[model samples]
Target: KGWGHGIKTTCVTRLDAFVSPEGKMYYHRCSVEEVIGRKLGPDDNLASAKNWARQQVLEGKDWRGKPAKFDPDARLFACLSQGEKEKLVEPGAFHVAVISARRGSGIV
Candidate 1:
């Protein structure tokens, strides 16, 4: 979504901020119109854009100001220890388990 491709030209933008536990703050500009394509119905456009924006806010914070080489594998178990950080599990067997648990209603 960062590339110029697949982005709408006339759109409103927003600056989102995130503060980590260490009190460091990070900010990024987000384009809402680019996220809502013309192909979508009016209601669908709003719902899809909102969902995509929320997911972007969540995942963007996870990688903010970090090197591209950051290895999330190093912190898998650590995040699991904190129930609130369970969203961190992804891209591997842990992610599979999470999907399974969600389907099984083991997680809300």
Candidate 2:
């Protein structure tokens, strides 16, 4: 099910941060590619990404330094809504996914 809008790229800019449950912040310089997936619209791509993240957690893999809730480097918290933050999973093992980059740098 889709709205039938073909995926297209439009130049844009956004400021975002990835945070941990503990309040540590990781800055993310978002790009259209990182925010949107290839061959799929942003909505579809984001859904896929979320599903992938859930799978990673279920696989018993350590997220540390990568992008899992249990990961020491998972910065998803920064973007999470306040209500979502209140429901954070594995609060004990959350950590910021730090990134250092200059302005206008691409994620990939």
Candidate 3:
């Protein structure tokens, strides 16, 4: 069910107010992990994240801050994307996940 998906320590240099599709996914994952207080494993139930987000949204905000469409801050935090073509294509066929990272975020 996967092809070239991975989370390596690749230092992408940029502060262009956006992140790549894959990059969005990474940040989104990080956001979820931050909320849940742990890193997700490959075998974890990803839908659980969605469920938790939905619960949060119903209570107040849509925790799933989709790339470009939402910010990973504020009430409705915008995170990243998964393999869902529907959510993936929400921004556009070729869209970038807008972000507001400080300078040298790419360096680590």
Which prediction has the highest TM-score against the true structure? 2
How displaced is residue 38 in candidate 1, in Å? 7.0
- TM for every model, in the order presented, reads 0.20, 0.24, 0.23
Q: Candidate 3 lDDT, tens digit per residue, 30-67?
A: 55566557776866554554465455556664323342
Instruction: Write model 2 residue lDDT over 2-106, tens digit each, in one string.
Output: 111122234264534433323344443243334334343455444654565466567754333234444444576676789987876785788886676664386
Please give the CA lDDT of all the candidate structures: 0.43, 0.45, 0.44
Ranking by lDDT: 2, 3, 1
| Residue 81 Cα positional deviation in candidate 2, in Å, after optimal superposition | 35
lDDT of 1: 0.43
Candidates sorted by TM-score, best first: 2, 3, 1
**Per-residue alpha-carbon lDDT of model 1 for 4-108, expressed as tens digits?**
112333447644443332434444233233333334245543355446556655665432322235577667666566665655545564533335644785555
Model 3 weakest lDDT span, ten residues long: 14-23
Q: Estimate the overall C-alpha local distance difference test score of candidate 2.
A: 0.45
Clashing pairs in 1: none
Q: How far is candidate 3 from the true structure (C-alpha RMSD, Å)?
A: 19.8
